[model samples]
Target: MAHQERVVALLRQPNSMIAEGFAFMEAQFVALHEDIYVAQPKGFEDPVHPNHVYKLRKAFYGLKQAPRVWYEQLTQYLLHHGYDRGSVDKRLLVKTTRNHVTIAQIYADDIVFGSTLQKYTDDLVEVMNKEFEMSIVGQMTYFLGLQVKQSSEGYFISQKKYAKNLVKKFELESSKTPRTLISTSTKLSKDDAGPPIDSTVYRSLIGSLLYLTASRPDIMFSFGMCARHQSAPKKSHLIAAKRILKYVRGTIKYGIWYSKESELSVTGYCDADWAGNIDDRKSTSGGCFFVGKELSIMAEQETKLNFSEHS
Candidate 1:
């Protein structure tokens, strides 16, 4: 059948019948298991004696294919029940009715979804719960490390707690706040003359900062510039990172707010710093996109800019 026809058929059925069908389908796969295996040298010896490699009979957490298998199973189930995958975002599924629209987002085993019609959303949760061993987390608060707050005004998503944790992890909670993430007059380069520091520590700081940039785009450009010198980070680079931490400590509660009154139109803003890099004389460009007033995307690029003295 055509995709639209299939969806119409599913919607025409009584909700109770559809719910029961989903229940039966879920039971069939509840006990299905996949095997796991590990390889070892044939002559490998244990601490007490020689031993052979073992093959696991059931799927384990660390197996590479476990997530893929689970997702395939879930996607098949949803498709069978009339949900159509979104063209723009593969992780999204859409089900539409004459008066209502429903959206379901899949992130591995976790699901975040909503519907314009309360009944449709309620029916969906009922069918899904009947089929799979699932946990409904109520309204989405925190998912995938982003803190979500839904209010009468709209929705607010932030990483304030995560930012605070990052500052504490790096022992920068007590550091003095900086006026800015990066100094406007300062330029960073691969400092060959600077002494080496612990690469592991530098890398860890960079990793934490990178994650923080998800909600804190203000420091994105500075963090990216400092990250480039991770292989040979110097005192200067470390200071720059510490400055970011100081900024975080001072503004830990700052976060993005999405208002209900905001328009859905997408708009973007771009700015560039010409010859921002001292040694390389590279210009840095930064851009942020908004759907209404809520930020939807942010990016930064570093470009080599030629400079010459004029007469």
Candidate 2:
């Protein structure tokens, strides 16, 4: 899913790429019983072979081999049409020409496609519909839990509903709003002496935050700090983690914005906070790569060895 930013970068790079249209597709599949002896869907079974299992004509969703079989079929179809699969991400397919280009990304059952030419996009949609039961969802606004809003200026993606639900899920909807992602003056320790909280809820909250990080990099650092104490979270850690939700409450609409006026250049910046964690005295470092401030990549870590003094 992090590849989304890079995909946007490709769309915004002028002279090479232009978003003609965005479409979503779902592959049709017929389900067969996992076990040969097990009964299958009412009429899908073979007429001649009553006791024998029916052969699958297409990939069945929820089956272990369904994704692989579907990809195989789709891959062959795209390759037959002159599309080349990505070297890094096998699910990414690209077809380029002197005048135009088309890129398609496949995630499980859903596919998102865009091209430099509107005719190409339309033709691709028509062709895919002819071959398979393609859904032909026009102009992708929602995919994989991320809500995307496209405009003449650029694209905006966020999990606003998910963020609000998260706040309410933890019963913090009415809590005081937090301005900061984390309180700078406060220090969180192991807090082994403090009262313990439910590990299940704490872990679930962390998991939700991790998914929210897909479009909300602002909470990544604070989430990481709170995640480390998941093994045995204390009241202090819970309070700190809840602070992030309160912060989300205040800025529910915050999200990653990709402007169409992006430059075709990659810029990277990194920062280090020496001995930031009082519990272990570990320095925290984080970095982000920007394609003209679009935030293509983000990463952070807690380093046990202090390197600030050496530098």
Q: Pick the candidate with the highest TM-score.
A: 2
Which ranges of candidate 1 are over 4 A from the true structure? 1-62, 304-311
lDDT of 1 by residue, 1-311 (tens): 23323223332333211111112222323322555557655557465645555566534444566556656766777788888887656776777778556667777656777665568878788878766765555667787778987665666678988988888888887788987888888787888898878989999999998988877877888898889898889988998888988998898877777555665466889999888777777888889887657676788888997668999
What TM-score does each of the candidates earn? 0.77, 0.83
Per-residue CA lDDT of model 2 for 129-234, tens digit only, reads: 7666765557778777888887767778999989988998999988999789897777778898999999999999999999999999999988988998999999
Superposition error at 205 for model 1 (Å): 0.5
**lDDT score, candidate 2, position 20:** 25
Among all candidates shown, the one with the greatest lDDT: 2
Worst 10 residues of 2 by lDDT: 15-24
lDDT of 2 at 205: 93
Q: Rate the local accuracy (lDDT) of all candidates.
A: 0.70, 0.77
